[model samples]
Target: MNEKTNRIGILPIGKVPEIVPQSIAAHISGCLDLPAIILPSLKNIAGCYNENRFQYDVGKTLQTLESIKFKDIDKIIGVSTVDLYIPIFAYVFGEAKQGGKAAVVSLYRLEKDTHGKKQPSSIVLERAAKVMLHELGHLYNLFHCADEHCLMHFSGGLQDLDASPLYFCRYCSKYFLDARSKS
Candidate 1:
């Protein structure tokens, strides 16, 4: 485990679109200036699926990340197509353990509009990148930002997420850069 080497892992769970894992890895590597790789998919993540709720428990899914850990992997993000929820909320685009190196983002809520219309690939990709970075930001020790459009801001729904950019705000950007430098 060489702490000096920074490598992030992007893994798809369940029935996520093929592009999401690569999209997450590309965004992290290209935007964060860190090495990123896609790990093997976790197909059985749906085993934790709630039949009545029609949503997956994200907190439990996050625990599964521990089994996929490798010495060189500094962080891991799991991408999923299923709806995700925590006990505190009805649904979440993603969830992360504060200060932990693992996170998961759900594409289920990000794929459609309020009218239940499917979003274009461009829009879907953009949303995925934003949510991925937002969840990863939490793992990086960043809080929900005050700026509404910042990637690190909390998004309770697709409209909120769509309103946000794929980039962090100035303060968050500085924090991410500073932390990367120290690491």
Candidate 2:
């Protein structure tokens, strides 16, 4: 697939680790050979906050991503350091509208100190990129890989995420290439 024109835009929702945006973009570019960029931060997260749960509602955040004004961005990813949740699930690493333009990842659970312990920056970045790739895979209509080692594999938590590599499996890679080539 020709990747020169494929651009993935990342939106940071709130205060994030300085390394996150560029780390993810570089990882995505190198792993998928696609042009990925750090887009402007998506502040104003208050509108999406749920007072009762004290977590950001991902559904509302996706609405925000859909309404964002960008210049020919191929895919939109919203990254946040805050805890994120949907109504049904207690927590999610990220969520994407199946085959949709927008996806969101929360660095909250990706952080080792999520319950209150500090984590090394390197591990943090790795986990964040893993989750982003997983969600972005969904944006491209790539389903959860049956292969446990693939990036497209569904991750229930940090351990599950850490077990997968930062790239897609070969079978999934073919699907990714075909989908991206057609797009």
Q: Pick the candidate with the highest TM-score.
A: 2
Candidate 1 local lDDT, 1-183, one digit each (tens): 233356888888867778878887888878877788888777778566888888888888888886665767888888888888987788988889987878988788888998999999889888988888888888888998889868888888788888888889899999987776655
For each candidate in turn, the TM-score is: 0.92, 0.93
Q: What lDDT does the true structure give each of the candidates?
A: 0.82, 0.85
- Assess candidate 2 and give its TM-score to the true structure: 0.93
Error at 43, model 1, angstroms: 1.9
Best by lDDT: 2
Worst 10 residues of 2 by lDDT: 1-10
Tell me the tens digit of each residue's lDDT in model 2 across 1-183: 544446888788778766799998998888888888888786668888899999989999898898887886888888888888999999888899989989998888877754667678898898888888888888889998889889988888777887889889999999998988877
Q: In model 2, which regions exceed 4 Å deviation?
A: 1-5, 113-116
